[model samples]
Target: MHIEDLAVPSVNMVRWGAPKQWLFVTPEQENVRAFEEKCRETFPWRKQARRPQRAATHCSQFVRHANVLVTTEALLDWGIDFSETICREGELVVTLPGTYHQVVNMGENLAEAVNVMWGNCGQVQSTYVCCSRDGCGHTGGVSQEDLTPEVASQ
Candidate 1:
């Protein structure tokens, strides 16, 4: 799917809005650790900087108390590219921590997605019980016992 830059940052994985799901990124595409160091060296993310290398925060919260949406140019200046990109069928998409990006479907389609969160962030745990479908949270609120994979397998 083709991702057009909406000049905003958001997560749209495994989505069914308007058509299909979408995913999106930058920073020399370095390894997670190097990228985190790069961000610390390049920008003053401060509080947000402390998030894990694989961690990602919305543009609104990427900066501390900025209270303003982040601009593509602003991200670009920090050596993070915010250009429009495409994800072919079955290809995996990943977004970097603290970078701003957009994801949109080019046509009607079907796909799956997963989310990884850094343990350091605030409320690292989900408030609601997760869906039995592994990695597909936010949809199920089963009791803790039923949410377990063993019970799900049975």
Candidate 2:
């Protein structure tokens, strides 16, 4: 629903709401660790996960709490004659969240980024719109509708 432009190798903020904005940057092990500490200093009770993609080549067939891919080089030149292009990298196309957005690293060098997610303690659940994928469909935002006190701790 929003677009952001950032200079290469710089940190960019993506505001999810209130104090939940994510600061995305290239994966620096130290910075990633420090950022986690800061998030905990504020919300000490939220569960978190920070890990590397299983494959050093292409990403696996799965999803994360959120993603911040750090491409030191260009991405693959794939065509998207379908789907609405919501964001771009200097005219190169990129997919937005809620869509089946996948990427392939074009450079032979390794690329990296750090992803941080909170509220994973049964407080939020992933929800999709029309359909998961294929044909006309786009996923919706994560939902907190089922987080009644009784269900939250389950």
Point out where model 1 deviates above 4 Å.
Answer: 1-81, 118-154
lDDT for each residue of candidate 1 in 27-127, tens digit (9 for 90 to 100): 24363234344444545544333433312232222322222333456455655444555656655556543343445566776655443333332122232
Report the lDDT of model 2 for residue 149.
33
Count of backbone clashes, every candidate in sequence: 0, 0
> How high is each candidate's TM-score?
0.30, 0.20
The root-mean-square deviation over C-alpha atoms between each candidate and the true structure, in angstroms, is 11.7, 18.2
Any runs in candidate 2 off by more than 4 Å, and if so which? Answer: 1-23, 48-86, 89-154
Can you write out model 2's per-residue Cα lDDT over 15-134, one digit (the tens) per residue? 222221121222344543343343334332222223232221121122222243322232112111122222222222322222223344332322233222224422222322121232
Worst 10 residues of 2 by lDDT: 1-10
Clashes of 2: 0
Give Cα-based local distance difference scores for all models.
0.38, 0.26
- Return the lDDT, model 1, position 100: 38
Best model number under TM-score: 1
